[model samples]
Target: MFTIRKATVADCDLINRLAQQSFPATYRDILSPEQIDYMMDWMYAPANIRKQMEAEGHVYLLAYNPGEQPVGYVSVQPEGANTFHLQKIYVLPSCQGQHCGRFLFEQAVSYIKSVHPAPCLMELNVNRHNKALHFYEHMGMRKLREGDFPIGNGYYMNDYIMGLDI
Candidate 1:
């Protein structure tokens, strides 16, 4: 069984730890160790996660298995009057084949529908080479454009911007 819950401020530590394990594992073959380490520290530092929740209005949903272990998590940030940015989504490496990602995504969509209740757009950026593009496409998101986003420290994320109408 699986359960999804809205993350609280106290969940920062858990989110940090989950990102530490999931982020690197997911990108192990695609990113260099240095880049992966840099990105993890940039994005998932406990302080950053806390800031994202408290100050930036990012909503996080955590997925837990029946054993009560967190299996995946996703963060969404409202970007405008009608657009929500899917900032981060990661499923534990061991849990990838179980459709945890799709479940988490559906939960996100359901939350938006409940809270926003208007014609909305959901947007996300995916690394150009990530195979998860197929999953997003299957979920009804389309690639709108591509951009090289600079994340400071001389690193850039080359990504495809994808969008889904909600």
Candidate 2:
């Protein structure tokens, strides 16, 4: 069985590896190689991830299998009062199609709701063309905005900001 739990410093390297392996597959067609590299470096570097984990307003969770190998992760940061932004959600490609992504999402939502209460909103930005957008919508997230955000190095992400009120 798969289990979801809070990430720790020891899990950073595994999370970085998972990010490196899973990111290219997910963003290769939607983003340039340069952009992918930049985002991965900016977002998934072990130091950066550790900083987020140690930050006051961020929560990072890891998913593990029966053998306790890390297979997926989700990161959330406070956007404002009563609002949280999903910084990233990634599942190892080998683990896809098994409802692991949905399971992580539901677990993240449950965590946020329990911790934040007050009818907080959970938000995430998805590449407009990513099939995950449909999954998010199907999971009851509504598109709140759509726009292009430059991801540096002359690359931009055409994305939809999706939100779910808990």
Candidate 3:
């Protein structure tokens, strides 16, 4: 069985390592190497992740296998009164097709609903060309908007903002 729990500071290094391992496989074909490098440095650095963990508005969750090793993670933050942004959801490639992603997503949805109890909506952006877009759609997320998100240094993410109301 897999277990999910709140992440602690000690998990930062492991989280960063996971991001490094997963990000390239997911983005190397979708984004330029420079953009991927910039994003990794800007978003997954230990300091940035630790700060997010310390922030009241953000929540980071980890998924552990039966043996208690983390194999997946999700990061989320409040976007508005009743909406939350899924900043990232990553599962190690070795563990990818085993339903871990779905499990983590369900936990996130449940947590947000319990905390907000309002008309809670979960939102995330996916690259238009990403093969995983179908997975999100299959998981019941609808495309709410589409636009270009500027990431900096002349790089932009051409994405579709998908949402699921819980």
2 versus 3: better TM-score goes to: 3
Q: RMSD in angstroms, all models?
A: 0.8, 1.4, 1.3
Per-model CA lDDT versus the true structure: 0.93, 0.87, 0.87
Look at candidate 2 and tell me the lDDT of residue 28. Answer: 90
Q: Residue 160 in candidate 2 has what lDDT?
A: 96
Worst 10 residues of 2 by lDDT: 49-58
lDDT of 3 by residue, 17-110 (tens): 9899888888888888888999998789988888887874668889998889888898888887888998888888889998988988888888
| lDDT (tens digit, per residue) of candidate 1 on 1-166 | 6799999989999999999889999888888899999999888998989999999989999999889999999999999899999999899999998999999989888888888999999999999989899999999999999999999888899999999999
For candidate 2, write residues 62-123 as lDDT tens digits. 88878887888898888879899988899988889988899889988988988887899999
Q: How does each model score on TM-score?
A: 0.98, 0.93, 0.94
Model 3: number of clashes? 0
What local lDDT does model 3 show for residue 1? 75
Candidates 1 and 3, the one with greater lDDT: 1
Ranking by TM-score: 1, 3, 2
